[model samples]
Target: MSAKFEVYLDHSGQHRFRLKAANGEIIAVGEGYTTKSACLQGIESVKANAAGASVVETDD
Candidate 1:
């Protein structure tokens, strides 16, 4: 099966988001939102940091 990722903001308008797969499996969860711009920048940082990284999938 293939998985899709998503992003969201917390109730407090904080970027305390969670990155999960289409199957609802959590990949990563974090909180770092002092500002909206900073939150977006943090997302970019996560993607950049993941570039060329290996993705390990385990069978359920």
Candidate 2:
């Protein structure tokens, strides 16, 4: 299994998504949206923006 995004509904019936690893742990979570289509668009936005994203090293 590969890392994947899952969409689900909250208690308020708003849609949200989580990016989970194959081990079934959530690594990232998405914002709540009023509609499923918009939720999907959020996923697409992540896909589009993530490809070119750069990592920043945080000083400890």
Candidate 3:
């Protein structure tokens, strides 16, 4: 059970996406996009950048 991205339509007819963990948890939620292509691109961008993505520590 590997992590996967899921694209779907929301209540407002906008396209959205989410990354689900192997355990079926919603690890990340994407912003709404006007087109499915953009939604897919968003997923692709995540795939491309997530490998070396960095975290910026901030004061809480």
Candidate 4:
């Protein structure tokens, strides 16, 4: 049981994706895209760039 990405259409019929943890909790969500391919590409981008991504606190 590992984290996985699930792609699907949103209520507005736009493509979106959610990253779910092993326990099935959604950990992250991607923005809506007009095409599924684009949505998948977004997932790939996250996979490619997230490993070394820096975490910084923002004052909000």
**Predicted candidate 3 versus true structure: per-residue lDDT over 1-60, tens digit per residue:** 999999999999899999999999999999999999999999999999999999999999
Q: Which residue pairs collide in model 4, if any?
A: none
Q: Which structure among the candidates has the greatest TM-score?
A: 4
Q: lDDT per model, in order?
A: 0.70, 0.97, 0.97, 0.99
The sequence of per-residue lDDT tens digits that candidate 2 reaches over residues 1-60 is 999999999999999999999999999999999999999999999999998999999998
Using lDDT as the yardstick, the better of models 3 and 4 is 4
Task: Give per-candidate clash totals.
Answer: 0, 0, 0, 0
Give the Å error, residue 39, model 4: 0.3
Candidate 4, 1-60: lDDT as tens digits: 999999999999999999999999999999999999999999999999999999999999
Residue 8, candidate 2: C-alpha displacement in angstroms: 0.5
Error of 2 at 49 (Å): 0.7
Clashes of 4: 0
What does candidate 2 score on TM? 0.86
| lDDT score for residue 33 of model 4 | 100
TM-score ranking of the models: 4, 3, 2, 1
True lDDT of residue 21, candidate 1: 76
lDDT of 1 by residue, 25-59 (tens): 98887675867677667767877888878989999
Q: Measured by TM-score, how close is model 1 to the native structure?
A: 0.56
What candidate 4 gets wrong by more than 4 Å, as runs, is: none
